[model samples]
Each structure stands twice: as structure tokens, then as C-alpha cells.
Target: MAYKDSSKLLPPPSANDIISVANALNTLKDVKTTWIIGKISLTPGQQKFWFEACENCQKAINVDVGWVMRCPSCKEESRVVARTRVGIAVDDGTGSINTVIFGLDAEKLIPFTTLQFWEAHTR
Candidate 1:
């Protein structure tokens, strides 16, 4: 399956020096750098990875009747206009990191849209 969206690709490891996931974690806390890791593992339970988030404040929205969602914090009501949020555990042999991908990043990472995946799997 293919997603129908243009995605900005993350820079290649060559452009950003490859580092161990352990080192990446430590340095990330102290400084900012484009550290890359090889052999990323998405882990399991990808079905739970994606969820709906409010478009206005980007917070998780509660689904309501008629395919509508209400944002608790922003108090905004939207009609099925939520974006995808993805959580994954990534490992590069050295260490593992749990990260959440949202917006365009989640769109880029997901090969298929949430609706498409659900429909395909439901049958």
C-alpha cells in the first residue's frame, strides 16, 4: 500500500554522523545534534501506534457521535478532522528509545493511512 502524501525525508546518516543509540540518548539530553542510528526496529503492536489528535491544539481528542471529535483542552469540535499520532519503540542494537511521531512525521512513517489499514484488516 502507498500513502498519498508528500513527505520530507529525514536526512541520511551520511549527512548526520551515525551514532549508537546509547550515545544519542545522552547527547540529546545535553545538546542538539543530528545523530543517526542504523537498523531501527519499530517493535510490536503497531495497531496501537496510531491515534487521533485534535487539529487545533494537536492534543488527543475524544471521539464523539457522528464521527465528530471534541478537544477537551481547546474546546474545539471537529468533524472527523483529526491527525495521526504514532508511538514506537525504536532500537539500533545499542539501545532502545520510545518515541512519538506526530503530524507530518507520522504521516511519513506510516505506509498507509489509518482508515485504509483498518478497512483492510477488518475484512
Candidate 2:
């Protein structure tokens, strides 16, 4: 096939990278994050999908009921930010597997910030 714009074209699809749910379940460690085609299932029991992480050390703090937390990991009173943590299930023709999509990835997929998600869920 003759190509006009090669830069806009995707690399030729390879079966080596293209994986199914069956293959993912059996050989996940062997596969690289090259290609995946599946449906993202947002039906999970866990309602909350965010956590307060320390600003300095980026660790999960123990403090609750506030935005700022005294981090035990960093031994400092650092500001805590709600981080995205979405759980999703990917399903191809074969089967499905549960996966946690965290950080910026979750935020990009869900179309909402962690704070926004919490506010929306609460109401």
C-alpha cells in the first residue's frame, strides 16, 4: 500500500504485541505494554478511587478528616493531595482481568480530577 502521510500512520499491527485477555491472564509477565485492545469495565464494588499522598515523600499518610497531613514517612507536616486510583477490568474475546489504573492515567481515562470524583460521588 502506498502511504501519503507516514508520520500520522500507526506502525503496522503486530500479533507479537497484540494480546487477548486469555493471553494476558496466562502470560502477563512475558508481555510488554505495547498493544492492548479491550473494553474498560467500570463496575467494581470499591466506591472510593483516590488516596491522600504526601507531597514530600509521595507516601500514603495515616491522617484522616483533613487536606493536610503530618506524614510519618517523611516526618514532616506536608500537604496531602487526593490522587487518582481507578480500578478497571479489561475484557477481550477470551476473558477478563482486574487491573488498577493509578495516577495520571486514571485521571485521563475518567475525565475527572480526584477531588471532582469525590465531590460527584458524595452527592
Candidate 3:
């Protein structure tokens, strides 16, 4: 029996693109917080904590849920942190972007230093 060569016909994959995709995928899987490319509309109350934004983007990045303290004066409840567990690539007017799937594992990873503000906020 003669065997046919199947590998020769396939196109070569770009290593850089593969790496980028892998990194994005890994980020989607590991991160537990979901943020969008938008401005912070609400002010932090007594129980509120502000997280630093990205240096380049200047957008509200990661939020510190743990830093949030209870306020006896305002009688406000702690803000619930939301996460993006699944992500799909979306096309904005300018270019492609990532849309987060809400209410998933992404909520759990909010407070870790390893999760940068910009990285957490941006798609």
C-alpha cells in the first residue's frame, strides 16, 4: 500500500500571530474581571476604591474589590465586581476589539497584582 503525503499542501502558520492568539486566549481564560474601553462614570463613595488606569490609555483599569471599605455614613453596600470569562473579537469603527462574556470566572481574579489595570480594562 502506498501512503500519500498530506502535510505538504497545508499553509504555514505565522508564529507571531499564533503567539498573540495564544496570549489573548490565555488572558481570556485566566482573567476573572471584565472591563470595557470606556470612561469611569460614577464616583467612588465612602466604601468605594479607585484603581489606577493605564499609563498610555488613561482608562479606568483594574478595580480593587478588597480595598473597598464599608461606609457607616453613607450606608452603601460594597460594589460588586464583574468579570469577563469569555471573549469574542469585535470590530469597532476603527479596528477589531474583544467583547467580554459577562458573569463568569473572570470575576474572581480582580485583586491580584499580576492583573494590570490596562490589561484588565482593555480588550
Indicate which candidate wins on lDDT.
Answer: 2
Query: Which candidate number maximizes TM-score?
Result: 2
Each candidate structure's TM-score, on Cα atoms with residue i matched to residue i, is 0.56, 0.64, 0.20
Ordered from best to worst lDDT, the candidate numbers read 2, 1, 3
Q: List the residue pairs that clash in candidate 3.
A: 32-106, 32-107, 33-106, 34-83, 34-84
Distance (Å) between predicted and true CA of 61, model 2? 3.2
Model 2 TM: 0.64
Candidate 1 deviant stretches above 4 angstroms: 1-19, 27-35, 64-66, 80-82, 118-123
- Which residue ranges in model 2 land beyond 4 Å of their true spot? 1-15, 29-35, 65-77, 120-123
- Candidates sorted by TM-score, best first: 2, 1, 3
Error of 3 at 14 (Å): 40
Q: Tell me the tens digit of each residue's lDDT in model 1 across 32-82.
A: 644555555565676654455555655555563226566676787755444
lDDT of 3 by residue, 1-123 (tens): 000111232234444433333344456677632232322122223221223323222223354433343333334444423323333454323334454322212334244332343355544
Model 3's TM-score against the true structure: 0.20
Candidate 2 minimal-lDDT segment of 10 residues: 1-10
Expressed as tens digits, the lDDT of each residue in 40-108 for candidate 2 is 888579778887677666566655524676678768888876666788888887988787766666777
